[model samples]
Target: MPRRCTRNRRLVLVVLFVAALFVPALANAEPAVWVVKGPHATVYLFGTIHALQKDDPWRSPKIDAAIQQSQTLWLEIPNVDDSASMQPLIMQLGMDQAHPLSTKLTPDQLAKLTRAANSVGLPGGEAMFESFKPWLAALTLSIAPLMQAGYDPSTGVEMELKPEFVKANKPVKGFETAEQQMRYFADMPEKTQIDFLSSELDDFDSAIEKFKQMLAAWSAGDVDALDKLNNADFRDKYPELFQILVVKRNQKFTTQIEDLLKGDSVSFVAIGAGHLVGKDGVPAMLEKQGYKVTRE
Candidate 1:
């Protein structure tokens, strides 16, 4: 072949080869949970599913009561709706067209997202998604259906924990700021993001399938099932990412919890359910340190 033709052939082969290597990692990840314990305080390690179908049972009067009795609220990030509270930070974190997420994919791959969004019956059709960031798009893909069903983020143990605490003027704090949480999206290399978004794009059917099994486990209070689903392997390999995302953040809240006990104030820390379960879970870490956690 001519030199120019040979170079073009090699380029096409390289692109195809790279793509083949990426697609399978997309299919295997699962999310789940486990529980842990500590002294002087109770940390309920609940594994949370960002999305769930309408009919799973995970009512915890214990958790409700725990929130009511606790002195503060701790979370993975400051609440998303608390935009005014974190506006400057959020602005600094925004992504733009020069960094345009879609540019990372072929036109065909992008079109698949359109079909995926439509398949799940998302609102305003195409207009609903305009000007949205890829991370927000991923967030929307993960949670909307569960919202559409009966799972209310607003009604979850965390949301309910807020109003009552605020009524008492209790302090609500986040381990990380809004910019930090949102960066989990912005920091992804373009291809990894495409992988993230693509998994979410046409994700409803698979999400629905997983929801069924997830619900069964949640209803049964099968913490191990939740842990298995959360995929401990992914957590193991990505220790640094996991630390930034969950563990190190959990450590910040632990200090606050320790301080609370000193004041005779029983504080309720509501974090992502996943944070409380497993060997790496807060409760386990605390138990190792001698805090007694009683699961209800």
Candidate 2:
């Protein structure tokens, strides 16, 4: 693939992750929450963002009530507040001592990557990213600009709601471990990783603007717009990644949710919004399985 195409592809992936991290604004429509009714139980599924601005308006009375009513809270991962536990795992999966990342890129790609790193005020420029795997490098670069703009991962919806659930004495659980999630990137084919890095470098300049548009669509609860902006390009251009990161995960989560529905407890499931829309989304998949899924 041309580097430009690769860049656009990787940019879409980052946008999906970042946009999924925070709840959208829901300006003209109801926020994207769903009720899945089974014979024995009910589960509330709320789309979430990983990080967000402090003042972003994402909470509504309906969402608040759902949180309060639920006996169990399920997040993508648990203990998001405990970043310390992830440090060793990140190093194990992300660092490359035998070969620096610079060896894998062309001179021009390396230059672009360096410029991107500097642009985001990441210390050490090219040197800083030298030991990182391409996927990790791209992810770091992708999140840096957003962080610089005051979007905090700590202030993301998941973190904000976690304490509330804890205070209420509700049990919290995770779909995947942080280690498992890291391995998804670490185990990618080298070619794919290179493409990911090149794509991030190519798309770095426009990422902030694209993210803003995505956030707007999310806030508006415009599922069609979110699907088009977040999934369309990725599904078409990077089917493998789309399958691995979104489709397959959604399927696995569906099975877990089915198990949850077999019980009588009311559960609140907060996951990335990206997993809850489009043809292959969780809502559609659940509906196909004969579960009555209604938007709230």
Candidate 3:
């Protein structure tokens, strides 16, 4: 249905989708893949880039054909409403009361967090967000720099695709309700949140650079590049987290995709491009299930 990433890291999803791989560790980039077997419910996997330079090349012709052929547009979460939905959870997720923020982290880490926060124009870290899940905060922090870099969520592809989908009266469906999506945060263990926050806050600039490199790979449909950018180390360190946000969801979405291809629904399935490439990615998963997947 849609693509998701570790935690609520929508920005991370954005990064992975566009910034896929490199030739050294990664093989190469390729174009969009398709599985339009039946005339009824075939799905055209159109990977999406939510943020881009206004001049970034929209180079995939197969993707454009899928978009034109599909009857409706779908997305991960419906809108930014999830941010509002996530506020309470974020507040509750603060440094536990048993170990107040003062004791939870060293002054240096706090300072770093604040400095990172300020770099993106976010209010001071002291601002109440205790209930926030760490992953959610990481996501916010991850996207902050991008905003400063001139990326606007408002200009994201799904945002741009909405008017057309609505005008065509195409049924717009949300894969998960806002609350269900918020629960992804609610259910996370606090330690995971803190660890993620620590890692992200500690490496904000590197993450940005990684994002840049990843975008380069994704532009070429390079699955190999995507895999390297996917970072085996990160996946190993947070296996369950990665499973929940990426692999597990990819598995479920694959089922939905299968059903779509068996019907009359001409679907232009645009997800975070990351889900379509890489090992155990959607294309591979579909292939394993005996479906014929091919470059468009």
**Candidate 3 local lDDT, 203-266, one digit each (tens):** 7877668777776676666667777676565577777767766687678778877877777877
Model 1 agreement with the true structure over 182-238: per-residue lDDT tens digits: 665567665555555665565455665565565555556555775555536436655
Q: Please give the ranking of all candidate structures by TM-score, highest first, separated by commas.
A: 2, 3, 1
Off by more than 4 A, model 2: 1-30
lDDT of 2 by residue, 73-154 (tens): 9998877777656666766887798899999999999989888888877667788778888888878786778877877776
Instruction: Tell me how far the alpha carbon of residue 47 in candidate 2 is from the true structure, in angstroms, after superposition.
Output: 0.7
**Candidate whose lDDT is highest:** 2
TM-score of 3: 0.78
What TM-score against the true fold does each predicted structure earn? 0.67, 0.90, 0.78
Candidate lDDT (C-alpha), each: 0.50, 0.78, 0.59
Please give the lDDT score at residue 145 for candidate 2.
80
Model 1 segments beyond 4 Å from truth? 1-61, 77-92, 123-132, 202-204, 232-244, 251-263, 288-290
Could you report the Cα RMSD, in angstroms, for every candidate shown? 12.4, 6.4, 6.7
Report, for all candidates in order, the number of backbone clashes: 23, 9, 30
